[model samples]
Target: MKPEAHYNTGPNELYLDVRLLQNLSGTAKWGKVLAVLGFILSGFILVFGLFMQQMLQSPGRAERVADVGLSGFTIVVYAFVALVYFFPSLYLYNFASGMQQGVQERSRQKVGKAIGKLRVLFKFLVIMLLLFLVLFAISLVMLGTGLSDFSLQ
Candidate 1:
């Protein structure tokens, strides 16, 4: 095998450098902000869902909601939305914190974990989007079929 032809094909190390660190720092800061905002939004949604009854207690509010076909399940839907929004926020927060720590300490392991979390977040979001898309398509198909059947009758 002729001693394997020793050549230094570089891919062994990645230089972080100051500029890259700065950029990562900026991204981490934004991620933290977005995470915090997401958490707050989820909290607001949960609170609103819980308090939906009280909010709709006024004169015709309940009637209007009922007329719109959102009478009872409003709270459930809002709670579900809030719950769905919370995980991505949590992942973003963890990624941001880990990335910041990694940048500060120049730790590859920390950065890798942070990136892993980001990947998880993206995967989660994409899966959720796909589910929602499918759900929407199914709903539309059902609605169209129902309307056509009604029209035929």
Candidate 2:
């Protein structure tokens, strides 16, 4: 008699193989660490940006405008870079869950899916990063021109 393969049917009956689950757990841990770091860095950028804007808006603050603007731009760029990975990492997490369930159920469809999905996910991440870079460049240009207040009397 041929043995029946265990398959994870759906959410209610999801199962995960021990080895695969371990691997996924490890992957998730690293990903989570990255997410936390990104969040922290983004927070710093936001706070610094606020401070810069405050300084720029204050009377006689124009004296320091050049340095503050440069620093603010750097912070915004860093935040944008951090955010670039946000959505794609979220997708990767979903894929990891799917993979875990597949392994547990020994589902034929789940076994090799994560590998392909990761490639696609990474591609999307890179594209997002590129988009952020372009937007950042635009922001720098706009800020440079709008804040240019050199006066000659």
Question: Candidates' TM-scores?
Answer: 0.80, 0.47
Candidate 1 lDDT tens digits, 72-145:
67788998999999999999999999999988877777888899999999999999999999999999999999
Off by over 4 Å in 2: 2-17, 63-120, 129-153
RMSD of each: 5.4, 7.8
For each candidate, the alpha-carbon lDDT, in order, equals 0.87, 0.63
lDDT of 2 by residue, 28-132 (tens): 556556656655665666676667666666677666777556535655665565466455655566566656555566555664575567677788978877987
lDDT of 2 at 29: 58
Candidate 1 whole-model C-alpha lDDT, 0 to 1: 0.87
